[model samples]
Target: MPFLLAAALCSVLVSVLLKLARRLEVDVGQAIAWNYVVAAAASMLVFAPAPSALHAATAAWPALVGLGLLLPTIFLALAGSVRHAGIVRSDVAQRLSLLISLLAAFVLFGEPLSAAKGWGMAAGLAALTGLMWRPSKGAISGGAAGWIYPLLVFLGFGVIDVLFKRVASAGVPLGAALLAMFVLALLVSLVLQGWRLARGTARLGARSLAAGLLLGLLNFGNILCYLRAHQALPGRPALVFSGMSLGVVALGALAGMVVFRERLSRINLAGLALAVLAIVLLARG
Candidate 1:
């Protein structure tokens, strides 16, 4: 429970930091790139993952590479969603991505459907519609463009979750898999940033470096605590899952409202409520 709490806190803190990064003039791309470096280093140090096991033939290269590409991309999307949609909506969108993952399970992997899952999916779709609604003009914020980020955040995380599930099913060691993915992600991020730097489109700054380092620590803490939670509750992953999902939504809403003064309409709040219920249902399923 302590581990689960810590993971939830760290997850929300990541969004808060990213929200602040804009105000602090931090280069998000640079920070995210450097974040991978820090995360990879921390993962290697803490897990002591065997490098020999990462050989191309032994490792799940395709899934690892896919996650590597998706991680930074979805991270950027998360930041964007936090900025435009507020942490409340962004966090809900992220957690509700379980819906998409469940869908993928049914479709791609042919996982059996249950009554709980059916109800959860129905509620989750409604939650998405409600969360994305902006009361001001009967449309989502950022016009069509603004809505894309959160939608992407939702879909992107779901896709990443699916990949992780596949990797886990293949009997890959979690630590080694994470290490490989983070290292690959760092390389991919560097290449993208390098291109931007050459084009004079982005500049790396000291603030970006510092923020990236901090973000890396928080990000790693989130993963560490989450894994610990699973370790603590070996047979009941659903408890950890529900705890994490609910904790983030509740805390994120409070933080966005109190610390950031972000506003949410009644419909948005309703969506958040439904999201929480949906997560509970999915956990039961």
Candidate 2:
């Protein structure tokens, strides 16, 4: 339970760090690249001696590689989503990823879905619809791309979750698997950023680097807590993870209102309420 709470807190911190990065004029791309680098380093330190057994656990290699390719795109989409939509709306949209993941788990892994889970899914969908129902007439950036980014982010994260579960179940030590995954993701991010740098389009200045490092550290904390939660409770990580997601979104909403002075529309407020109820149902499930 304490581990779950830590995971939730870490998730909240990640959201807050991202919000701070935006406020500080940090280059999102560079920061994201640096974030992966730091996160890889942190994971290595946590699981120092890369075990030879991990080599034998190569059955999930393809999935891990695919995940590596998807990760940077996920971050890019999430950053873009936050840029176009506010944090509250972006997070609300992002939580919809859970539905995708749950369905994938059910179909691919044969995870069971009870009546409570069904109710939870319904509530979550309601929340997402409410959040996205923007009635105000204003020119939002990214247009159609804005909507696409969040959905892509959701798909990417769902893929990662399914892959991670498969890898973990296939005899890979959680620590080793996490380290390898982060390292691969970092390499992908670096190559992408390097290409941008070569074109003189990417900024690698001090502020961006610092923000990236901070975001990376926070991300490391989140990964650590998540891995630990999974390790400690081998079955039904979804409940704990759903709780963490709710905590992060709630905290993000609060920060949005307090620090950014962002006003929530009636629809958004209703979305928040529905999200809370969905999490409760999820936990019960």
lDDT of each: 0.89, 0.75
User: Which pairs clash in model 1?
Assistant: none
Worst 10 residues of 2 by lDDT: 133-142
Displacement of the residue 253 alpha carbon in candidate 2, Å? 1.2
Candidate 1, superposed: residue stretches over 4 Å from native: 56-59, 137-141
Candidate number of the best TM-score: 1
lDDT of 2 at 29: 79
Which structure among the candidates has the greatest lDDT? 1
TM-score, per-candidate, Cα-based: 0.96, 0.88
lDDT agreement of model 2 with the native = 0.75
Candidate 2 per-residue C-alpha lDDT over 9-94 given as tens digits, one digit per residue, 9 for 90 to 100: 66656666665666788887788888888987887788774668678887978877877877777888777766666567667666
The runs of at least 3 residues in candidate 2 whose Cα sits more than 4 Å from the true structure, single-residue gaps closed, are: 1-5, 138-142, 229-239
- lDDT tens digits, residues 76-104, model 1? 99999988888888988999989888999
